[model samples]
Target: MQIVTEKLLNLGVDEDKEINESQLVLLDVKEDEKSEWKALSLNKQLSDARAELFVLLNGVEDKEIQDKIIFNYKALQKFRKKENDKELIVEKEVQIQTHERGDVTIYCDGGCTPNPGKAGSGIAVYRNDKLSELWYGLYEEMGTNNTAELGALYESLLLAKKESENGNTVEIKCDSMYSINCIKTWAISWEKKGWTKKGGEIKNLEIIKLSYHLYNSIKKDITLSHIKAHAGFEGNELADRMTMYTIQEKSESFVKYDKEIIVVDILKMRA
Candidate 1:
């Protein structure tokens, strides 16, 4: 649980850190059916903890460290499941490949101060590991952190499209799992469901739609990867700094293209 606490702290989830960490450390038991329910709930908590740990450790290049983490994760998964449940199976192994020459990488981040207030997004595009372009902008109106994140991705995709025209593969690196999930995975289900979630209305539906469309329109190969925020990745760190700058300075001059200018205008209008 200390590891969980440390990971949450690294992720900037400070508000519930102490409480969640304490919950993991302490447990109450009673001899009744309610205790069975409590056990199930505790299992859920353990599963969540294991998932967070996996996310934090993902994309690690050290084979020894990756194997150890995977072993622990699989053990925890097995321990948490009921006897009647199917056994956990390793699906496909994930091999993290280093960015290759001629690969175009885009590192993007977005955030807001005081949630739903003063939101902004930033992007850093790299060509063959060299910084090619940088952009950041403030939303004209208040928006959630996810919106800012998606905005960064939207802009990055646009840049990727341009770069891909020269026959380079595009890889997008971002810290927002929500935004990544929306485009890469959940959008397929949402499309099948007529753009509705079972829980209710989907947030930022229009932006999601536009982003999904843009992603498919690009003819070149595109890859999306989630990176841990503020974790010393140079491009990601630069994007994060740009987001902070936009939030604090309220300036828009960092962006360079008329197309980008039009995109920001559309984002503000949609927002």
Candidate 2:
């Protein structure tokens, strides 16, 4: 109830209206019932009344202001729906829960600039509803898009291995089903042929093998899934951006001495 009250306060339900107590009643009542509170534009009047009440109580959040200024009827309904959902939370608590054995989800991506040029890898972890961690790094030495992508999956699988526990399900999601499939099945055949395989020298055998090892260790307790990227998938795009950002930074690999290196090289060649 405290959570509900705080949220209602956050949502800006007025004290005088006793909206918390009256809302269920009002919400259940028909549109005709609100006739006593009439306006020339009844819908507008109701919308304004609701917005004004909440904005007065919720202190006019930026999102609320935009909605009011735009006067989106559906948006108003959504706010009402969200408020009702919050109220439902008041009725939804379990007094006891422990050792939840959480479900983990990871989003992985990698990319390189100039095709085979500087590259980066990203692994973003989410537990339940919110994001937990993001692992992003660049390959200053040498890397390809596929290499970085594989590396991202490797890192994500490694993290999942670390977080894996008895009976808990961990889901790894990627835009690349190719990457997912590579680690899942191609590993066994590659290992059988001494990591070289008929595929003519499995590129990045070392990390691929390590990823296989981690996957095998946690396979009994994990679930891996491939998801379409950038369909407004929050974690996927976030991880992709992290990798892309790292890729952008990869071209400027050295910080303090890159110019000095050029100057030194020029002077040395002259000598």
lDDT, candidate 1, 86-146, per-residue tens: 2211110110122234888899999887697788888877778886556777453577799
lDDT of 2 by residue, 133-237 (tens): 555674544678888888888867765665564344688888877677677988888778777666467777777777788888888877778888778787787
The C-alpha stretches of model 2 lying farther than 4 A from their native spots are 1-101, 166-168, 249-271
What do the candidate models score in CA lDDT, each in turn?
0.64, 0.59
Per-candidate TM vs. native? 0.54, 0.52
**Model 1 clashing-pair count:** 0
Runs of candidate 1 with Cα error greater than 4 angstroms are 1-101, 251-254, 257-271
